[model samples]
Target: MLNSINTNPGALIALQNLNATNTELNTAQSRINTGKKVANAKDNGAIWSMAKMQSASSSSLNAVKDSLQRGQSTIDVALAAGDTITDLLMKMKEKALAASDTSLNTASFNALKSDFESLRKQITKAVDNAKFNGVGLVDKSAKALVFLANADGGSFTVNAQTLSLEGLNLTTALASFSTVAEAGSMIGKMTAALLTATNKLSALGTASTGLDTHLTFIGKLQDSLDAGVGNLVDADLAKESAKLQSLQTKQQLGVQALSIANQSPQSILSLFKG
Candidate 1:
């Protein structure tokens, strides 16, 4: 090629090649630093958009998980209280049964009556205290609870249970173990109330199990969504590392090539000097 100081074609070509190498090297370095091939919309618009959408979904599931966890904890508190009420009912049954003995003396009967009343009051206390996150499952404060199940606005509901004395059909009149006949009547009521409390506990236990199972499913689903986002955007560090090394070497070579091309005009100077 003809050499000119004003326009050396070889230097122009070398500079163009070097610029191309520099661009590629910059891209490799960016990937290595960010650990992502498509870190932004400029990287790959379509893939980046998809990855952003999936990542948003994965993040939203965090809220859903929180809802489920709160629901689970609320149910756990109710279950604990229900179990306590069940045990207290069993003890109340024993107290009422003992009070039913007609041969018992007045002093003994009064003492047994006082004991039964104390147990009944304890059951009320358990029902009142079965609350979490401002929700009471056993006290009839909340009719039902709904928890977010997924990113699509799906939900699960846990029906509330009223375990109060009146709710269980165990009237305050039964709390009056003041006489032998009343004591005898309380035995039958206690049995029925015990059955009701046991059934409620069984149902609550099932609800808790369902919550646990769905929580596990949500966790796995979130993991899958995260993996999907990674697949769409994450760069292979090993491949990027190798590519960066290769590009660095090519950049050095490109600089040397441009330097040699720039010196081509010096040969014309040598000819003129001789």
Candidate 2:
């Protein structure tokens, strides 16, 4: 190799190596600090795009879960109201049976009728109050509750079952039961109403169970999508840590090598002095 005072090829080569090592060190430290192998699209365009799409899907599924939860709550409220109405109907049946006895005085029959009327009004109140998130599933004219089942706008519907007095055939006018004979006839109607209400309650319970299962599936699906995104973009911290140590050592050695290369040009000066 020809020695020159003006230019040192050795120094240039060492500087280039040092710069490369520094670049590698920076990349390793960035991975450690951010904990992401592909923090931006520039790192890996295809992987970043795929991860972003998966993340969006996960977000949509979260919304679907929320819808399912709301639907479940509505069904649960309606089921509770139906059960309470069933109890009220049983009590009303007892009162009707008592009033059917011809031996009862007029005053005693009136008192029993009043209690039955009150119970009937309470059933109406219960059905009206069985609302969740602005939806009344047991109201006299309830609409179907629809919940998103997936990110693609597909839905699951919970059909509303009315549990009101009119729906249950228990809305007979109080004035229509003036005679003990009429009160006796109401027993059969009340029994049929109770059966109808019980069936409606069972249906609502089943719908609630179905919604719960859908929610569980949504949760599991979201977890799986999240894991997939992580696999695509998450950094291996242990590997980054090891690379950081190795690059740091190389950086130090590169600097020393550059210093030694810079001193080589000075040797040409010594030759001139001699």
Candidate 3:
């Protein structure tokens, strides 16, 4: 059986060519409007996957940076508490010096002992209260932040050990300072307190510095991820403009060629008679 051609062949060819031209024009328009070659995942499968990966990385970096910032803040709380503890120790030392005075009588010595013990109590209390959102770097309960080894898809941990301000080695603090002798136990209590305060201060300072270092690293990582995302998905205006002009030219040429193809069947009409 022959395929019957009832319609004008020239018109059919013109219609087909026009449809192709229209399709090309629609594609060019889409790219121009969206400012991206792969506006949808369906446009370019591999490129879309790469873009999604970049986006996820950028988001993960931001989250890590935020965690670092919070960690730094937690360290700040510990550091402040450490400073207070040192101050209390200094006050205890002052009271000890007063008690050491040779002229101090029994009542005066007793009073000095009482004041030094009170100050020691205050330091302990201060350490206990210094906490940021219940994450105490000082006062014994300190926790380190953990992150995945890979940004996505992994079972891993970035373990930073919890440190404590309450770990000060205050040996024989109240015991040695309780007695008022010729040497005046004030010196011993005060000395021990100073040593404890010193170690606590050092630990907190070290921890704070480490927090700053980690935060800085996280910030840099965020910046790097942002750059990668830009490279992968962001438009280059200059390049896009050039491409736009080239596509416009191609689109125009395509239309003209389609018109010429439509004329092919028109030539056949010259041999036809009614």
Query: Scored by CA lDDT, what does every candidate get?
Result: 0.89, 0.89, 0.63
lDDT of 2 by residue, 1-274 (tens): 8788778899999999999999888888888999999999999999999999999999999889989988887887888888889999999899999999999999999998898888898998998899987788888899888889999999899888988877887665632377799889878888998899988888888899999998999999999999999999999999999999999999999999999999997777677784
What are the models' TM-scores? 0.94, 0.93, 0.73
RMSD of each: 1.7, 1.9, 5.0
Provide backbone clash counts, one per model: 0, 0, 2
Q: Worst 10-residue stretch by lDDT in candidate 3?
A: 155-164
C-alpha lDDT of residue 42 in model 1? 96
Candidate 2, which ten residues in sequence have the lowest lDDT sum?
Answer: 169-178
Clashing pairs in 1: none
After superposing candidate 2, which stretches have Cα over 4 Å from the reference? 173-176
Clashing pairs in 2: none
Considering TM-score, where higher is better, how would the candidates rank from best to worst?
A: 1, 2, 3
94-155 per-residue lDDT for model 1 (tens digits): 98999999999999999998998888888889988889977888885658889998999999
Instruction: Give the runs in model 1 whose Cα sits over 4 Å from its true position.
Output: 270-274
Evaluated at residue 39, the lDDT of candidate 3 is 71
